[model samples]
Target: MLKKVAIGVDIGGTLTKLGIVDREGNLYAHMDFSTTMHKGFGDYLDELKNQIEGLRSQIDFEHEVMGIGVGAPNANYYRGTIEHAANLLWKGIVPFTDELKTRYDLPIYITNDANAAAIGEMIYGNAADMKDFMVITLGTGLGSGIVSNGQLIYGYDSQAGELGHVKIVDNGRLTGLGIRGGLEAYVSSTGIKRTVFYLLSDMMDDSVLRDYSYNELHGEIITKAAEDGDPIAKAAFEMTGKILGEQLANFTAFSHPEAFFLLGGLAKAGKWIFDPTRKHLEENLLPFYKGKVKLLPSGMMKKNAAVLGAAALVWNHLQE
Candidate 1:
């Protein structure tokens, strides 16, 4: 029997990762290139095409290639376009699928990376047995995908479940989107960094974090500082967890998911992040919802998760 696989492409601001994955989410072949290398969309597409051909060559001839699936920022599933992605070189609405179709005769699908992560969870991760769940991606900024009744919720405009944009405070920290009080502005990597600065000012505790400038600090550095018993860094995690947990409790009132899987950079903080989040989440939940929802890490952590998610998107749409 011929092996079946799908081509998964995950486009980020700096890097583009593509891989061939089986139905089981097992990665077969993978490669990456700098997304910023090409200044124009057409040039980028040509480079992507060449990369895909090179990746396909690594697999045996007996394998049957399926369709291509892409996970990108601001990607529209219904329209098959990337609309005004803040980080991409391409501006406005780029006809992503149409352009790909012009080059390759195959079924192509696309969605925002967060939604792809949710589908990937449903198909291959720990959420494989879960019908309803939400995934919170905690990277430079927060992104979320909500699944209810075994379906990913795409609102009327193919843009729904933006949990990160929900206002959690009045006139709070501003985000890159120029929005204030958005949850992402408080609970993401950048959010925690901001919290650290606030803590440093409010508390006069001696700490190593004070030595580094704003540009030099990142999630890993802060995590290390917290691990080494830095008071300011630890406090930042506490504050972030409090805000995220309170908002999560509020979100539960809306969808009541079976679980919320935390993925990405900040989540890697382990106990520094999870302990406080779990504590506050339970504390804030209504009595009826208490102890009902489980908080878990993503099962796709060990693999090329984004690529698998993109491929899972293809397998899922094909089944539908």
Candidate 2:
């Protein structure tokens, strides 16, 4: 069968990724553009329209657009809207899906980045056969996508899964869920750094990290140190993984997902994180579920995952 080429757009706080894809999740041409703040909260759709059109001319879609799919921060799939997204510089609700439809004259699928990532996994990654699973993204902040019944679970108003904000520690962990401790507080690189700063401060012994400002200390630096077998860095990653793993056990009671796909900056910490995560998850999981849930790395390539997800959403929408 001739595959229908679909366009996928992934909009983040600072950047946007776009691509042309097919039902099989094969992406042909991909590009990126900046997301500049629009003046007076006006239409940034014009820019997107122009850019997509410009790309279409170069790529030459054989079957025309099957559909257009998008993944954005605070996106509502059910409503086809972008709400007040933090760090996205938009004051009011933006009818992004509707705006794109008018320009492209085709079906448009819009979802939050987390949901899109999950969809991407369904079509392009390891979860193709699993109806229930979760994709956890660890970066500047944390994000998640839930899959149930071989479909993306777009909850009421499309805010179904915001696992990062789920409170883990009693009282204020740091502002996630208005409480202090949460999954994000550990798994997120930002959270790891905070813990690192506190750990380092208490050490009373100077280390290489002492030279760098906390703001300047990034996930990569810590990761490199861990690779070199630095005890502090390694300990930080272990603690992070332990926290993440423990929470997965808690969420499993509700979702019964087969596997949890971990992605993004902190996830790459590898065994330093995964080992502890596995151990902790095993410790807390229900006896029957203990050996069931697997902590797997995201099969989707980091750069391609979001765009592929956005495109896969359109493909999924068409099939539905």
Candidate 3:
């Protein structure tokens, strides 16, 4: 019998990554396409089809393609649509899975990128043996996936885990959702940049970050500066961690997750961000829950985490 494989697609703001993956979480082959080139959804679909066909040709005769799984921003697992994802050029509700089904007769699964990361953790990462945990993706925006009793919590509408949108501060940073005080506004990579600017204004500390304009500033620069012992950069990470830790504590009260696996670019800050977040989270948690929930970096951080995450959706579906 040939080993079964699944196609995993991860659609992001700038690029779309797809690959062939097997049961052991190995991505056999993968490729990318510029998402910005296709303004229309139809054109995007055509390009995706072409690329997938190209990937299919690489598979050996002994392997069988079993299913397809997609991880995209604002994707709905229940509806199989991308609903008003602000970052994408295509607007409104996109019948994503329906469009793919038209081209291929196979099992298709779609979910928000964060939820996909959670499933990835369960299938390919550290949470495989754990019954409860949360996966938080901190990129341009923050996204979360909560797992309970070995199941991803989709809630009623397949959109339960929007932990990033939860309010943390009164009149905090404004988010793309046009909301104030969102956790993403404080904890994401963008949030770190914002914090750097905010600190530059309030504190008279002479630092390297003060040299860069707002448009030029990024999370990497801040992390580098912090590693170099810049006061402003260190302060920025501390503030971001403080806000993130408080919110994680709040989330703990509701889900009581055994751990939180932080993924995406911001997690690369290592102890600069984690130390403060862990300290604050433990301090804020209720006495009984304190010290019980662990905050850890993602095990798949160095791997093609998003691609593996998308593939994990198919693997998870097979079990169900």
Candidate 4:
């Protein structure tokens, strides 16, 4: 029997990843490239086609490429377009599926990256048995995917589950979308870096983080400093977690999910972020919600999770 696989594509502001995944969740021929290096979306698509053809040449076994699944910022599953994605260079609504159709005559699907992560969890990760859960992607920005009663809530406009953009404070940090006080502005990788700088100004503590400039600072640097017991770095995690945990509690009051899986670079901080977030979540939860919801790392953390999640869209759609 010829093996069947789906081509998964995850497009980010900085990078684009591609992988071939089988029904059994086995991944093969995965690769990534700089998305920003391309001059335009059309150029990017040409390179993507070339990359796909190159990937297929690497496989020695017999296989059938079933479809293409794409996870992109601001992707609309209903419309098959990426509309006004603040992170991408593309300005207007780009007919993503239509573009792909011109290249390959295969079933194609698209959704926001976070939503893809949630579906990937259901089909290939830890949430296979759970009915209610949330997947929080904490990278360049925060992205959320909310699943209630075993269904991914796309809302009326296919724009629901934007928990990251929910306002947390008035006159707070500004986001890429020019929105002030959005949760992601203060809880994402960039958010924690801002927190570090904020603490640098308010609290006069002698620390190693003071040595690095704003451009030099990143999640890994802060995580390393925290691990080394730097007060400023540790304090940043504490503050970021506290805010995120409080928001999670608020989300709980509404949807009441069984768990919230944290993914991406900031989540790699492990105890520094998780401990405080868990503490605040418990402290802020309503009486009935306390100790009921679990905060866990993503099961797909070690793998090309985003890629798998994108591929899962193909398997998921076929099932329906």
Candidate 5:
């Protein structure tokens, strides 16, 4: 008998990652393509179709492709569209799933990348047994997926659970969303870099960070500096963690999740980021919720987490 599998696609600003995954969350085949090459959405779709067919031809064993699950920026689950995704080359409301349907008569599921990550956590990560939790993706911008009562919360408009946009500070740093003091302005990879520059301007004590220009600085550089005992870099991580922890405490008040899974690049900073965030999360939590919520790193870190999460969307939909 042919084994059943799902094709998972994780669409990002610069690249799109796809993988063929089995029921056990094993990624059998995977590849990536540049998202910026296409001048129009139609061309991109054609290229995607070609790639999928190419991948299908490479499978040696008998297998049935069950469906396609896509995770992208600003994707709407209910509408099956990518709506106003600022990062992608496609603009306006693109009927993403519908477009794919014209090429292949398979079920296609679509949702924002963060929500996909949440589903991935539920199916393949530490949250498999947990009834409620949140998954935060700390990359260029902060993204969150909130799971409640064993289901991902899409809310009324299918665009709820935007924890990254939650206001954390009063008149603080400005965000791409034109909002000030959003959690994303402090907790994301970009936020950390922004904090480093802010520190350089505000603090008299400078260290290794002064060696690089603003455009050349990255989160890894700061992490390395922190490891080497740079006061400014250390202070940046601490401040980022403090802000993240405090907001997480606020998030707990809303959903009462069992834990918060940190994913993406910033989370990999290990003790530099986790230690202070965990500390402030506990300190800020309500007396009843204190010591109850756990902070965890993603189990899919060693694997293509986004792809797994996207594939889980189909598996999860099949269950429904």
Candidate 6:
């Protein structure tokens, strides 16, 4: 057993989550911070270094720091940088991993956040026993990490599994990726909001939602309303599921993974997402895969999935 620990960084458009994880997949210390704004690469890196070094001030443990693993939006495993991230306010490619590695003098590995989440599932979550699987992150955008034969399928240039960009509703809605009618256009946070707004106005009596501005409204609000038996909220979830399920059917045919692990904000909607997702997935799947594949929740603790997954990148490299 290693006495030291590796740091896992889960970078998102909204927040950055990180933790110190041991070889045994145990998380020790954790931090939540904002992603470096359009604040150039160096500025972003310095901010992260300061936050990480600050952790030493709080913990009184006797262990060495091993390395670092990062998960970010559009992170290219081949380039070790984040490319054209819309939410991060980045205009072009930024070499986050390389810059951080030079500053910290530590081995660093980086990949897209969704891929990290999938690896976390493989090494520490529900897919630990499976060789082929998919991990989907349903937040502001839909992200996916593909695992086949117990290894991440980064493909050439480390840009292999981009499940979100897969077109589901052609010409349906524009997405962050410059594609119209992609899966995220249907199932992402904004999609859910649109669904709710439409339902509140056109489908059901949504007095609860009609009161809030779309800017102030969020997926959580819809979930809460559903919990309170709001039919409009329920309709929104069902419609979201119908879209995701249709997309999954196509994804399943191509990958044939044993299971798909879901994480992120919209995923937390629970049955509001699951029930409809499951219903649509089964309805769309071919007869051959009808009863074969499974849709399991993250086996890794809910909030801990991203951190553990980022760490898994390090642990996975070590094991290799």
Each model's Cα RMSD: 1.2, 1.9, 1.4, 1.6, 1.2, 2.3
Compose the digit string of candidate 2's lDDT tens values, residues 239-286: 787788888999999889999998878877777778888899989999
lDDT for model 3 comes to: 0.90
Name the runs in model 1 displaced over 4 angstroms.
none
Worst 10 residues of 3 by lDDT: 56-65
TM-score (all chains, Cα) for each model? 0.97, 0.94, 0.96, 0.95, 0.97, 0.91
Instruction: Report residue 314 deviation for candidate 1 (angstroms).
Output: 0.8
Off by over 4 Å in 5: none
Expressed as tens digits, the lDDT of each residue in 74-188 for candidate 3 is 8989999999988899889999989988988888999988998999999989898999999999998899999998999999988899988888778988998899989898889
lDDT per residue as tens, model 6, 1-320: 32788889888777888888887777878888887553676777788888787765556677777788898877898888889887786778887777787798877989987888888887777887899999888877788899988899999888888877777655777787677877777788878997787777787474588879989999899999889988888888989999888888888998798998778888888888988888889899999999787776777646588778888898888777
lDDT of each: 0.90, 0.81, 0.90, 0.91, 0.91, 0.82
Once fitted onto the true fold, the runs of candidate 6 whose alpha carbons sit more than 4 angstroms away are: 37-40, 89-91, 204-207
- Report the C-alpha displacement of residue 280, candidate 6, in angstroms: 1.8
Candidate 4, residues 68-87, lDDT tens digits: the string is: 99999889989999999888
lDDT of 5 by residue, 92-168 (tens): 99999998899889999999989999999988888889989999999988999999999999989889978889888
Alpha-carbon RMSD, candidate 4: 1.6
